[model samples]
Target: MVWKIYMHMTSMLCLGVAAFFFGGLSLVSMSTGKCSLIEWELSSLNSLTVVFVLIFDWISMLFLSFVLLISSSVLYYSGSYMKGDKNFNRFMYLVLLFVFSMGMVILSPNLISILLGWDGLGLVSYALVIFYQNEKSANAGMLTVLSNRVGDVAILLSIGLMMSLGSWNFIFYLQDMVDEKWLLVKFLVMVSAMTKSAQIPFSAWLPAAMAAPTPVSALVHSSTLVTAGVYLMIRFSSALEGSKIQSMLLIISCLTMFMAGLGANFEYDLKKIIALSTLSQLGVMLSILSLGYPDLSFMHLLSHALFKALLFMCAGVVIHSVKGYQDIRYMGCLVEFMPLTVAYMTLSNLSLCGFPFLAGFYSKDTILEVAFMSMINFMSLILYIMATGLTVMYTMRLIFYSLSGNCNLTTLSNIADEDKIMSDSMSLLGLGAVFMGSVLSWLLFPECYMICMSMFMKNMVLMISFLGALIGYMLNMLSVSSKLSSLLYYKEVVMFGSMWFMPFLSTKNISEAYLVWGATNEVLNDKGWFEHLGSQGLYYTFSKIFMILSSLQMNSIKVFMKTFVVMLVVILLFFS
Candidate 1:
């Protein structure tokens, strides 16, 4: 046990050091407005060359630094969270592999190199998701992997399509290939990004992936796997600007934001609620990216990562204290027992809601303001407001249910914020959640955005947030004896609460339909046409012919004797 703790400390120290190194480099690159690309020629044949490209732009460097930082913290937290588990070492190894894969994705600019990292992430995520080795984990792993496989295939197709250009370095060629001739490659890249980021039809897997351990949840949802898609999209934003695909992306991201926010509000599972919030924030990043603001999206991505990871850590602490129970309905007035954790949770949750000057506010508020200033359609603008409100609503509901309400757990429940290792890990992120927004705002935006909106339009963001908070708190403030109001709108609750039946659509419905189709296929082909035209038919036909020959041989003895006699007589006549 001592050795395991040492291992965790050693890994944390190494990663923390590396994070600082890259962070300084990122700052240098950003300030100098310079980037470095190193290429190693792996092979060259027939005018096609495979190059392993490492890009050291401020974007890659900054993202890499954040990923390493979060990874180091998660490892330290896991040392406490996964204590006494027999497979603790194995879990640590998987996490390291996951971090390595994310680093590959961050540093590679070549499509082929990126695919290698992309696929590594998918494979490692599957391994980590099913780490518990249970039926639910198994199922969730399957859904997660299969959902990501769609994106994997998209990346593979993009690689194939890029072959015509003789080089896989898309960054150098995206602008030149912006015509319809290369539109499909850009579209495929976007689709792959969507799946990784869990947008729309692909959103089911993100919630299902909550079957993973909480440490993995924090890492996956925050800096590593899911954000890979947004990062990839940011890299490709130049090609996507002003295209019809961007418009479509805008619509899909808005729907995803609204859907995830609504679903989070209705969610009971604490982990699932946070997972859906991640989905909603991913939509925020992608939507801004689609609006031709990749830098803003990238800024939101970074700020969101800090608070989201911190939020998941708090969730982990709570789940650990409650002996693995996750239903928020069974948790109340936790602040009484775990004040420090609740404090961190509140900070992260407020940041998630874009509360003033918090980490989320700097990026998220800027996105809203810039989006409002942009010339978008009526529907998009309405969804922007609605999704924003829903974000605050769900956050408030979570806070009220888990922090201020009457106690729901047993009177003797032992819950406290005494885990030093876990607390230390969360401390750094808590600081980030409080201050990373303003820091990133200053760094990412050299010149501030000029706002000329009317007082009403300017205050609309505050108004919606306040309204959402009021509704969320008021709706959940019910006595134990009171009838549930949600029961009155059963259908609406069911629809919205279940992510509009996305899990059903992605898993159960699709599996059932395929099973029925397989049965029909068996009856029509494997057991029907192939039965008559394939091996069975040939066997029966050949058997019948052999039976006829056997009967002829058995029944034709007289004819055989007559033929022999005739031949003998003819021979005798010829001799004479």
Candidate 2:
């Protein structure tokens, strides 16, 4: 009990600190006439509009507030959940580091600052994921780090390119770059974003990330790291506009959404299901953002962070109560066993599925509406239809399989209600899932639709999407398998087969040597005899040239060092 009080106080103090920093940022941003709290002066404005720094700064603050809220709640829950565990101190320290790094990621002014925070968050996440130090957890952490590093390379390259061609200052370069240069930069940025957001081919890591504890998964997936990509998209939307890359983004996002939705349906693991669903939802937001609805994307990201965090926490409660078992197949009749948890989970999932008056309804509908408005061709329309259908399919599956399915009373009978701290955390996040939209709509956009048709269209789409979800629920009740089953089955086969083949097929072997030899022979055959010999001679010449250049460079370095030493001796003698 004393430990619980101490943890609660510590979390509260962290929140207080975050609030102070955010408030200071707000004040500075308001004073600076910058659109975001962190300001850089630019000579040219191009198509980008300049607003008071309060706008972007407020967005950063909002994200920071979410970090504080969810991290604090997790810390509070951990007080009881991790009680007397040997690694409890280590866990708390990593958790605090995770929160701090995420806060920095959000509040960071320039790309350098953001990268610093981003890498810090990734490191902390890796540490937390492997906190248990089991083989599976360590492997998962390693894979997560490896995959994120691929994305980091692209980001680093983009930063270098931006610094070389544009200004090293983010806002200045962003505003000054012409469309062509901006397009190139945006392409690199998109690659980084897609990898970080867990879109399409890069998405496999997020489900693997579920090997972490539930609170860590919640923090990584919803509130902080995963959302970084969407934040980047919104932040750089102006540069992305009118680029061909937007079409590619739309296509990739639609495909990722559909694939993730299909994967979620086949997932029996509760956390994996939610993790895949989070990926799908993020894909939808990315698609919407690509369609030129930054505001809607921001709103959806915020709503998802709230509800998904709540759902994950509630899922944590269920897992904790059941002694760490997470398979939905083994979990049933939970409504009666843990009523508060069920209630919170139900509310959050409902919100996730876009039930009326819930947070998800407002954001999801906006995405669908934006898709409809922006889709200009038959191909795009088909993609949008597929994406929407997939969303309904997976969201309904998550709701039905986890919460509304037939009960397994025997297994559930052994479980008990969660402790008070855990319950409090769930209740707080769940209430936000239930009511954040209405409150934020008033506070952030009172005139809302009247001020922006785009915003209005987004909200209308969200409403219709909610109605679509209800229809999907009814369709699910009718006991008909959605036509997507075959596709999902095929995907499963491909995924399993690919995993089996990757480690073996990619290994260098006689077959690879034969293939390489055959390809080389074919190229040689295509060339005339003289040409082939000439090519070999050219390669030899280049090898010799490289050796000569390397030797010259080494000689120069040696000469320079000797000269420097001599000069240093003479200077020392003169001083003496």
Candidate 3:
């Protein structure tokens, strides 16, 4: 009880801090023309320097506030979610560690310091992922940590390279790279960001990380861990301007958006659906950032964070009520029993679908409009359209499967919103998901978006959204067993649903080959030839030599005595 109260106090304290920053910093931002905060020197040397930085521009301040706000709510929710665990204090400590890591990442502009935060996040996330200590959690935790380690290495390398620039702080070079060859630093930073955001090849771990606790998922997956990458890219957007990497990022991010949307359509797990949705939104953030629109990307990031966090919290409520059955097929007709949860889910899901006047609408529509305005290739444009449609498609499919059907679970009949703590947390985030988009847009962009585009282009997204909804609903309700059998039984649909065989590639395939090689090496080298030839062979060889010497020594003593007598006699004769 004392620990829970302490958790509450700590969370409230964080919220209060965020509130002060949010209130006071807004005025500071308005009054001061410059967004850069006062820098505190951590260390200084001729060629290596480090500084503690707090970028108080709207982006950093607002993002940190949102992070702390969500964190506070997550901490509050965890009090109820983790009520009676044996390692409850340990859990809280891990959470605080995760938050501290995120805070460090948010405030520091130094590449080395950011790496400090970056590695901390990966480490704490691994601990949190494996907190349950089950087989699934263990496997997921390994994947999460190992995959994130790639990013850690990337940032570490970048920090080493930045030493050439005489400072570890990246803020000094945000306006431009030091020189042309320093593009390597930009590329390295981008790679680091991609790993954190779970883009393309790095995406397998995000969904797998769903094995973590609900609060971890709600906080890490939604607001902090994934957004770190997007925020990094946003910070480095100027250095990336006109570099070929942005074009590549554009293509990769678009495909990631499409892949996640397609995967979500086939997924039935409730938390996974939200997780994949988070991935899709991450792609959107990256795609916009790649177009050199960091401010717009920041807007989308903030909006996506609110809705996605609420979506996960709502998912947590459902999962908790349903007694850990996460399959959507077992979660039918929950709307009637759990109206508040359903409402929260609906609002967030609608926001995800770009429902007008909702939080997702403002940023999402802006991104699409900006994409349309940019002189992008036909392929990227097509991908953007289809990815948007897929977002709606999967969301509609999720709603139909989980919320609209008859009661499918046999264990519990009367489900309702009785958990005050969980509901209260969701309520706060729900309010954010509803209003955050407009608020962030107004605060970030004083001038409204003014883009010139054709009517077909303008209406195209809405039409695609409608078609996606139609397809999603039909796909869920349609009785096509033969079709599904062909799709599900075949390797192809399974592959698509398994995120194009990513988990297989990252886990079993990689582990199996290494395990086989390890076994072979152990048996053939360590045990067989090398073992015999090394220690045993040498010992046996020395023993045989020693045995022969012993035999010679024993036999030669008699001969030696006889020779000695002969020599003595000859010596006597010679003397006479």
Candidate 4:
């Protein structure tokens, strides 16, 4: 245990140092407007070459810095979170593996190398998700891994497609890859990104993955695994510009944003709520990137990672204090007990809601304004507005249920912010949640984005956000005597609450049909027709024939001699 403690401290210290080094390099790269790419030729074949490539740009460097920073914090937090677990050391190793895989994806521009990291992420995340070794964890792990496998296959197909180009370094061929002939490559890449990021049909795994440990959630859902998709799209945004695929992605992301936000408002599970929020934010990043603003997308991705990680960590404290009770309905007035945890949670939540001057506000607000200013269709604009409001509404609902109101847990419950390790870990990301947005915005965008909107349009964001908050607070502030309206519209509420039954659609709905089909096939084919007409039937026929032969053999001696004598007499008569 002491050795494990020393290892944890050592890993955290190393990550912090690496973060600072990369952070400085990122700033220098930004100021100098230069990037370094180092390549090593591994082998060569006819019209094909395999090489390892490392890309060091401000974008990649800064993203790596944040990944390491958050990873270090999460690892420190996990020391306390998983201390009593038997596999604490194994957990640490898996977390480190997860981070290393993400680094590979971040630093490598080559598709083949990226796939190596990508597959590593999928495998390691499955291990992490099932760390608890329970049925729920096992099921969630299976779902998460299988959903990710689709993207893996997509990446594999894209690699096969890239072979025609003779080089896997997509960074150098963005322009050439954008032609109509290369549409399939672009489509494959988009699908791979979507699966990793959990967009639309792929969104079910994000929530299901909350069955993992909270620290893993903070790391996986925030900066590393989920964001890989958005980051991939960011790298490919140049090729996607002015293409039909980009427009299609715009619609898909917006729907994902709205769906996740609305579902979160109805969600009661604490970690799953945060997961849904992550989904919504991913939509914001991809949507903006789909609009031909990769830099803006990257900015949001970074800022969101900071606050979202903080939010998840804060949630870990709350859940840990309550003895792993995650239902928000039973949580209330937590601020009275866990003041520091609640404060940090509120900070992250408000940042998610786009409260002014915070880390989320800088990037999220910019994305909204840029969207309105873009030439998107009216329906897409409506989705943007609706999704934005839903984000605030769900955030407010979370705060109302968990931070204020009356405490519903037992009087004997011990809830306090006394865990120093947990508090210390959260403090780092709390600061990031508060200020990283403005810092990233300024650093990434030296020149200001021009905003030309009417007075009404300019105020629309604040107005919708205010309205959403008001409704969220008012609707949830029901007295004990008041009737629940959700009961009146139970079906509709369930449909909306269940992420439009996507989990069902992804799991039970699809599995149930296939299971029924399998059962039918088993009974009708394997057990019934195949048994009667196949091996079983043949066995019976062969047995009957053997039975006849055995019966004939019983009389065989006399009957055989008589038959032979008759045949010889006939032959003699014919000769005569």
What C-alpha lDDT do the candidate models reach, one value each? Answer: 0.92, 0.71, 0.85, 0.92
Which pairs clash inside model 4?
none
Question: What range of 10 consecutive residues in model 1 has the weakest lDDT sum?
Answer: 476-485
lDDT of 4 by residue, 302-417 (tens): 99999999999999888887778999978899999999999999999999999999999988888899899889899889999999889988888898888997678766678998
- Each prediction's RMSD over C-alphas, in Å, is 6.3, 10.7, 7.1, 6.7
TM-score of 3: 0.87
Could you give candidate 1's per-residue lDDT for residues 362-435 as a string of tens digits? Answer: 88888998899898889999999999999999998898878778788866568999899999999999999998
Lowest lDDT 10-residue stretch of candidate 3? 479-488
Clashes of each: 0, 9, 0, 0
Candidate 3: what lDDT? 0.85
Where does model 2 exceed 4 Å of error?
Answer: 1-5, 16-56, 409-413, 450-576
What TM-score, computed on C-alpha atoms, does each candidate reach?
Answer: 0.90, 0.76, 0.87, 0.89
* Residue-by-residue lDDT tens digits, candidate 3, 460-552: 889999999998788777733225554546677787798898888988888899899999999999898988899988889999999977865
Model 3 off-target regions past 4 Å? Answer: 35-46, 479-489, 512-576
* Residue 433 C-alpha lDDT in model 2: 91
Model 2: how large is the Cα RMSD against the reference?
A: 10.7
Candidate 1 ranges with C-alpha deviation above 4 Å: 479-481, 516-576
